[model samples]
Target: MCNSVVLGVDIGTSSTKAVALTLDGQILGIATRTHQVDRSHPGRVSMDGEIWWQEFVGLCTELSPHAPGGFAAIGASGMGPTLMLCDAAGRGVAPAALYGVDTRAVEQIRQLEDAFGAEEIYRTGDSYLSTQSVGPKFAWFRQHDPEAYAAARTFHMPASLLVHRLTGAYVLDHQAAGQCSPLYDAARHRWIAERCELVAPGITFPRLAWAGDRAGEVTRTAAAQVPGLRAGAPVTVGTIDAWAEAHSVGATEVGDLMLMYGTTMCLVATQDHRVRHPSMWGSPGLVPGRWTLAGGMGTSGAITAWVRDLLGGSSYDSLTCDAAASGPGARGLLMLPYFDGERTPILDPSARGTICGLTVRHTRGDLFRATLESVGYAVRHHLETFHEAGIVPRRAIAVGGGVRSALSAQLVSDITGLPQQLTRISIGASYGDAHLAAGLLADTPPLSDWNPVVRVIEPRPEPAYDELYRLYRQLYESTRDIQHALAARHSASAGEPLPDHRATATAPERSVTAPERSAPVSPAGPDTPRSPR
Candidate 1:
C-alpha cells in the first residue's frame, strides 16, 4: 500500500497544481502554486512555460512527502489553447499567448475569413476564433512579431512543453491538439498544411500522441525539485484540464456531460459523431474514436466571486445567503456573465457582461441570485445546442469550486432540469490525468481500489427557477446593442501605436450583453430528483 502512490500535475491558466493519489483514485495529499497570467496590456496575455514547470516541481514536492512512497506514474494536464514558442533547446523565447479571450488574434480571424470563406471554415472544422484556440494567437505572433517568429525553432502547447521539461522529449497529446482547430483535420487524423498556411506558413507544432500514452520517463533533473518523484516513474502523456475534470466524475459514457463550474463554466460531452454547433464548442477530446461537444461560458463562478469581494468583502456564506434572500428570477434583475468575453452561443470575445432591470425595489439577494442564475442560463444554452446536435446528456456531473455550495448546484438543475452529481475530490483537472495514467500503467493497480468519490451533489429543480430562466433568456436580446456601445467606448480609449498584441477585436454591435452591473442573490437550493449518495 505504501508503494502504490501516483503523481498528478494540473497546469491551470493561472496556476500549477499537484496531487498525490493511490491507484484506486483516492487522493492522499494536495498542493498548488499560482503562476501569473501576464496581461500587462489589452489583447495580450502571456506566461513563461518554465514558470509552470518550476511551480509544478515545487507543488509535487510539497504534496509528495504525505504519500510516504514514490509515485507509480506521472500525469499532467493544463489550461487549453495556451501556445508556447521555443528555441531548439526547448526554452521559451517569448511568453505564451493565451486563448480566445486574447484579442491579439482578431486580425488573424479576418485573414482566415478572407483566405477561406467563413462558412467553409466553420462547416469543415467546427470551430472559429471565438476563444479556446491557439491558431489565431499563432497567426498574430507571426504577422506582428515576424522577428520572433523567424527565430522560433519549434511550437508547443503547455502540455507538450511540460512533457519535454519532464523527460527532455517534445511531443504533444492529441486531445491537447484539438485547439489547433483547422491545423488538424479530425476526420483525417493528420495536420492540414494548407489550412495552417492560410495563416502562419512556417509554424509546425509537435507531433500528437494519445493521452495516457507514455512519452518518456522522469530523470534526475526533475527529481531535484519534485521530492520523492522517482526518476524512472512511467511518465504518461497529458491532457487538458476540463478533459481531466470529465474523467474525475466518471463521465465516460456517450450522452454523459461533465459540467466544470470553475472560474468560468466549461461543459464537455461524449457523443457518437462530430458535433458542429455554430453557437457551441465541439472538439476532439480524450476518447479518440468518439467526438466531444463542448460548451463554455465566459462567466460562471467568477461573477459570484466578484460579488463576494464587492459586498462588504465577506464570506461565501454571506453571499449565498444574500442570493437565497431573493426569490427566483433574481427579482427581475439578470446578468449575462460575459464580463471577460464569451464563448458559446455568441462566440464573441468582443462581447461583455451586463446587469439589467435593476430597481430600487431590488435587494442584495435579488442581485446575487441573478448572478447564480446567469450560469444556469448559459448552461441551458449549451444544453440546447447539444440537443440540436443529437447529443442529449443523460446526466451531468459537477466538478469545481461551485460544487461546494448546495444552492449553486440546484440552480443549475432548476434551470436545466437535469440531475447533477458531484465528486469527492473535484480537485480540478490533474487528478483525472493521474487516474487515467495509473489505469494504463503496465503494472498499474485497479482504479476502483484507489479512488472513490466522497459525495455526490444532486440537482433539485425548483419551479421558480424555470420562470427565472425564461426571463434570463430574454434580457440579452433586449440589451444587446447597449453592450456593443460599451465595448466601442472601451476600444476608443486605447491609444494608437500599441503593440500588435495589444489591440483587441472591434466590439460587436450590442446584439448582446451578460452581466452589465454587479448583482447578488441566494444560494438557491439544489434541484430535486436525487441520486444515491
Candidate 2:
C-alpha cells in the first residue's frame, strides 16, 4: 500500500479511541466512543469489559473509510493498574475495576500495610498505593466475593485483556504490568509468585511482554468487526497510555521529562538508568534500557473541572483568566487536591481533600488560582524525590487535555520555574500508539523523522513562586495527620475499619476454579473456550 498508515487504539476509562496516521505524521482518520464509568458508591468505579471491546471494534470500522487500503501497522495503549476478571470463555466475568481512583479496596490496603513494613516498601520502590492499586482490589475480591474469586482463573489489566480478545494471545507490556505493583516486580521483571500469592493468591497471570513487543496480528474474524483495518496488520503489545504520551511528546531522550496535565498531573522522566523515588514508579518507559522516573498528583485538572461544575458554567476560561488576574498565592489561600483521595507522597487512601486559609475576602477566582498552583505544587513534591535521587531533568514536556490555555502552561512554568514544552499531537496516547505501531511495522516509518515539537514554554521564574512552592511543601507535611483523622472518622461512620500503613503490600486474592473464570472473555459473547489465536 502506498503511503502506508499505522492504526492506534487507545482504551481509556471514559472512552475508547482509534486513529489512522501516516508515517510522515499525517493524520488520516480518527474516531472515539465515549463510555461512562459506573461510580455507584463513593469508593467504587468500574466498566464492563465486554462493552469496551465492542466499542473499540465498532469505532475502528467506523473510522476506516477515512484511510484507504487499510492500515499496515497497529498498536494499542491503555490505562494501567486496571484490574478485571474473565471467565474461561474469556468474557468479562464482571465489570472491570479501575485504578488511580477506585477506593473499595481500603480493607485490602490495610491488610497490605500489616504485611509489608512501610519502611521496607519505601525502600523497595516508594510506590505507596491508593484504593487505585490492583493488588488490593484483588484482595478485596477474594474476601467479599469468594465465588467470583474462586471462578476467576486469571487477573489481567484492561489493555492486555483487550489484546487477548483481538489477537487470541495472552500478553501484557512491562509498563502496564509493572503498574500491577506487588503483583509484578519491576526490578526482577517477573511476576513475584510470593507477593502475588500473598496479595492475590492463585489468580492466574497473563504472559508478559516488553513495551513495543509484537503481540501477534489481528484475526480476520476480529478484523471484520472493525472497519479499515487489515487482518494481518502487525500488532505491537503496547505501553501504558501515560508512557505512550510521554513518548509521543518526544520525552524519550535522557533528561527530558513529561508532565501530563490531565485528570491528574503525572510526571515521567527519561533517564539512562532506573531512578526510584520512594513516592514514584521507576519503570522502563517506551525505550529499552531507559528508565522513566514517574510520579503523579492524585488530582490536577479535575479540581478545575470541579470548580466549573460547582459554579454551573462554561466559565473555565473566565475562571482561569480571573485566577491569573488575582495574583500569586491566591491571597494566601491554599488547596489540597485530595477531593477523591491521594496517591503520591502522602499515599493515604483515606485522605480527604482540604482548602486551608480561606478568607471572606478571597473570591472564587483566588481559590481557582490556588488550585492551579496546588497542582504545580504537587509537581514540585514528586520532583523533589527525583532531585534527591539525582534524576535531573533539564525540563519537562507539558502535554494532555490540560494544556489548551497559554495561561495554564505559563502558570505551571512559573510555579516550577522550569521550561515546559508543548507538542502538536495533543491527542496523546492514541497518537503515541500510532507512532509505536508505525515504527514497529517494517512497512511503516520512524518516529523522530515524523512527530516534532510545535512549541516550547521557557522558564519564567516569578518572585512569588519561590515562597509559594515553599508553602506548598508545608501544606502536605503539616496536614497529613488531619487528613488521616478525617479518613478514620469517615470510615467509622461507614462501618469500615480505617486502613493502616501496613496494608500497602500484603492482602489475599483468590484463583479461578471454574473454566469460565479462567481468563478474560473474548468476543462472540465470551461463552466459548479459548484456544491459540
> Per-prediction RMSD in angstroms?
9.9, 7.3
Could you tell me every candidate's TM-score relative to the true structure?
0.87, 0.88
Best by lDDT: 2
Model 2 regions more than 4 Å off: 113-132, 443-446, 491-497, 501-533
- Cα-based RMSD of candidate 1: 9.9
lDDT (Cα, tens digit) per residue for candidate 2, span 260-360: 77777778877765566555566655655566667766567777888888777648888888888888788888877877677665555656678889878
lDDT of 2 at 108: 74
Worst lDDT 10-window in candidate 2: 508-517
lDDT of each: 0.69, 0.70
> What's the distance in Å from true for residue 357, model 1?
1.9
Residue-pair clashes per prediction, in order, are 44, 24
